[model samples]
Target: MSFQRAQHLESINNNLLDIKGKIDVSFEFFPPNSEEMETTLWNSIERLTPLNPKFVSVTYGAGSGTRDRTHDVIKRIQKDTNLSTAAHLTCIDASKEELIQVAKDYWEHDVRHIVALRGDLPDNSAKPHMYASDLVTLLKSVADFDISVAAYPEVHPDARNAQADLINLKRKIDAGANRAITQFFFDVDSYLRFRDRCAAAGIEADIIPGILPVTNFNTLKRFAGLTNVHVPNWIHDSFQGLDNDPTTRNMVGASIAMDMVKVLSKEGVTDFHFYTLNRSELSYAICHMLGVRPTV
Candidate 1:
């Protein structure tokens, strides 16, 4: 009814229009644990691949237990899809020779991108290599692979402090990591501040914000605890009393994710990495909201 309100709404619409095709995004998926899950994983991949992601990464599990599964998934993606694939390589319970062999296997399969990580070490086990930085260096030495390392806006659980975490990230960059994908965080300010700190620390690699859509509040809280990411009380309050309502929960989750991306895009963040959890509905909806449509 008011001219001022009309102008405000117009500006918002124009901002959304401005973001169309101006953003780049990538998705992350975990290795499937079962045959049915494997079918689900490929279906999700096929659903999202048409969005033309920068690259899709398959996660490696803790220890060497999922090593073969991880490789099998990566190989299948590489063979079955047009999307560029990245394999998560960790130095958790493997020797340098074993790690190199895996890297070589990936190269032979034509997967060139490697998400280098210092994965969870076995209980009371000695460190195989020093850290992710070491893994980055080793990968570079083995081949000219495009490497990505993890960054934590809230600091890694094992780091002594935030500064130490940044230093570790710097080491990875200096050792030839091409990009840094951050751990998911709900508070956008945390990521903005971390981006500023990375710039101040002379880290020039593209640091993409990792976005996780929360379809389940309880599951999010548990994941946050494990990853050392803090979930604000307001988030819980927002989802409160919707315990048995899946439809409302998904609506609320989509709104939260869209709002976060809209704010980040306005703040000059053009790239995002979504932790898809091997599901496509939420992620596909979010990408569509951001104006990243299926290229097909």
Candidate 2:
């Protein structure tokens, strides 16, 4: 951090300190594959548990291959940790009865929260089936559970426009979603604007931006490209000379997230959800910079 950036951050830090309003945070984790991956996931969970987040979510994969693994992970987390766990439920390959059975299983296990979405088309398939009808229908069906749906700041890649996507989001919230977490996005402005547009559309559910800190620009770019998140030219310039420098790349990633959060906090948005990618160092570093310490 430069002297100028440090000074600005300190000012922001002071606001973050005496800001009275607690900055609620949550995280998203993927299901682990092997024993080694499971160990990493638990370690990451234990490391971040002391932060006392609002909730943590585990994502179900694209289809059947990983569904059982996702279920096992969610069950273990709920049983092992004190954190409120939200299981992501997608309508892609599963039929309506199968989806309900999963929800019933979650309810039986005391897992109440569900991240509902009409998931994207499965990989290499000629096209996606409209088997689930739509997210709103699914939301209505799952109204018995505390549900969270996906939001898109820049509009869904498949949506006609951002406004139209916001309408779709409003439909889900109306059907009984308690919160809406956005698809991972790089730009904070998109989230802020999306929030305003949600209010304009008279939807009042909590809209949380999914923050994805980039450790590898090459990988992040590809993920962003698929998700409709644009990598700014300035970001490219920031990482231009640091391709081979891991330490510098990490610093730049943290700085970028910090800058974006500073602007977001100014807009009265305190909640954050990091797509941790099962790594704790960068997420922990960014939280420390924001003055969110582990209070045990």
Candidate 3:
């Protein structure tokens, strides 16, 4: 190999070695809607449990059916695994009183961590009763729960501007959130700049980077569009002409995620959150590449 290529390989190796045992990761899973999906979710959890994630979070939906599933999954994980579990709570259709009761139930059942969010409105015309900061405040009133709130590196879709979005995040932190787990982004520089902005704004809470290992390019584009996350052209180029190939897609996805973590680690980012999309193979491979191994 050329000297330049050899040096690049050595640098990658050093980065991997540097981050071993220094990174803390968390995984996010959505509540499964069907029996088969539930089985798949459990299997993913079982496969990842050995890696010893800092915590696992279950996503809450806007409707009651999904709410119940989220709670059930959280409870089951708490009971079945030794890992810390966090429940996602949102202020969408529920009233303050109802949300308080839900918080109370979680606390009574020994679930102390919560990921609070301002869920999507049913329509543009509907106004939300409470935002994520409001939910954080309400959850804190019920108990001294460890709260996690969402952050957007690209900026929230509904925000008037990026500064407004940052202010909203600060409100959540001020209200009682312990940390902010960012929305998944492909651009590492966007996240680093956002982190700098947060520090300059006097927000001292840990802003953990959320890493989504892309399994399908089509699905990723759709999600990115909805969330107003920018999909860099390079990413588009990487997945070009690979739509029909699942195995190649998985390899590319893992390589992209691994490179992201290595760069983030060099910047002193020790914590990461993975949006598993209820599948573990890509996430598992990424974590393994980062030197996060199963204890047992």
Per-model TM-score versus the true fold: 0.95, 0.90, 0.98
- Runs in model 2 deviating more than 4 A are 1-12, 18-21, 123-143
lDDT of each: 0.90, 0.81, 0.95
Kindly list the per-residue Cα lDDT of model 3 for residues 79-110, writing each as its tens digit.
98898999999999999999999999999889
lDDT of 3: 0.95
lDDT of candidate 1 at residue 76, scale 0 to 100: 89
As a TM-score, model 3 comes out at 0.98
Worst 10 residues of 2 by lDDT: 124-133
lDDT per residue, candidate 2, 63-109, as tens digits? 67688888888898899989999988887887778887888888889
**Across residues 53-92, which tens digit of lDDT does each residue of candidate 1 receive?**
9999999977566888899889988998899998998888
The superposed Cα distance between candidate 1 and the true structure at residue 158, in angstroms, equals 0.6
Model 2: colliding residue pairs: none
Error of 2 at 43 (Å): 1.1
> What ranking of all candidate models by lDDT puts the best one first?
3, 1, 2
Q: Number of clashing residue pairs in every model?
A: 0, 0, 0
